[model samples]
Target: MAPELPFDDQEASTNLPLATQIFRFVVTGVGSGILDFGLTAILQYALGMPAGFAKAIGFVCGTTTAYIFNRRWTFRAEPSMARFVAVAVLYCVTFVVNVGVYTYLSHLWPETVLYSLLGYVIAQGLATIINFIVQRTVIFNIK
Candidate 1:
């Protein structure tokens, strides 16, 4: 017989209030965003890497950070391989969308700090929305 998982007995519904979840998510996002933006700036400005590549690396790092916190604190869920795979798939989609948006915005604006920040905000905003919704409704939903 297979070993029982820690979250196997968790209630099907997430008992936490939506507002609370959102608040936690936002807090987590802020931390993750700092990491993302900092890394992107270092790579793009200090090392002269291409903007898209820098942003991609930053996004992966930030998303990993978000996943760790969201799974443990925000959702109060135990780790599971299935959940990990689901999140990976979701991030894959968001990664494409995020990089595409950032790349497009980079082309439209001059190579300046303001433009880099702008592109980062827009792309990150879109990805954040998608991630929160999907994680709440599907991946982290204890069903």
Candidate 2:
């Protein structure tokens, strides 16, 4: 038999309106993005780490934070190993895409702080969109 969840099946369903979900997602994303961007900036500029490495570290940190909040607050879902594994797979795909986009844009653009920020935005924006869609329709779709 499957293990019981902390919440009942009814409670596990994500019934939030789409607008509310998107708003909460944006708020969560902004908080996560700050941590990501700050860590990347510090590692790359202060410690002289490579851009890709620094961004990878930052992305991991940010995504971990996002998963926690998105699961609990945004989706209002109980914990499940299946959901966890699914999200892990999704994040792995996004990780490659996010880092690849950032690396390519950083190389293509002139080396400037503004351009670096733009690259981060573009990469993060794409990743966020993908994450929201998959998480809503697949991983967190308790219905």
Candidate 3:
């Protein structure tokens, strides 16, 4: 078997190319968004949770997944408690913005089948932009 590459070696593959970083980030975000959206839909439609609250709950799940994958796959960073807590705090700040946007948009449009997805998308898009930028620059920077 081939010898395992060090964490830094794996990270260098992702770190040099900005395009690669963005692509990986977007892929990770899309995966987590699907999880988040699906969970929110289930909570709101099946369990009768309010749209805003359901979205908040779902965001927690998605954020957790994103942190794990982004740390391991996207950024290739070894685990650290300080990093995890920093991410948690960042997610908390983003959570409010995410849910606030969802709430406002959900109010503007009825939470019908189609509009529910749209509202989620719009809010997720905002959070996605914020997440990608900060995660790459501040939280996960290796250089």
Better of 1 and 2 by TM-score: 2
TM-score of each: 0.89, 0.89, 0.86
* Model 1 Cα lDDT, one tens digit per residue, 94-129: 999998899899999997888999999999999999
Q: Tens digit of lDDT per residue, candidate 3, span 25-83?
A: 77888889999999999999999999988999999999998888778767666777777
The list of candidate 3 runs beyond 4 A from truth reads: 1-14
Across 1-143, the per-residue lDDT of candidate 2 in tens digits comes to 22233233445448878886788788889999999989988888889888899999999999999999888777777898899899999999999999999989989998666887999999999999999999999999743
lDDT of the candidates, in the order given? 0.86, 0.86, 0.80
In order of lDDT, best first, we have 2, 1, 3
Candidate 3 — worst ten consecutive residues by lDDT sum? 1-10
Full-model lDDT, candidate 2: 0.86
Lowest-sum lDDT 10-residue window in model 2: 1-10
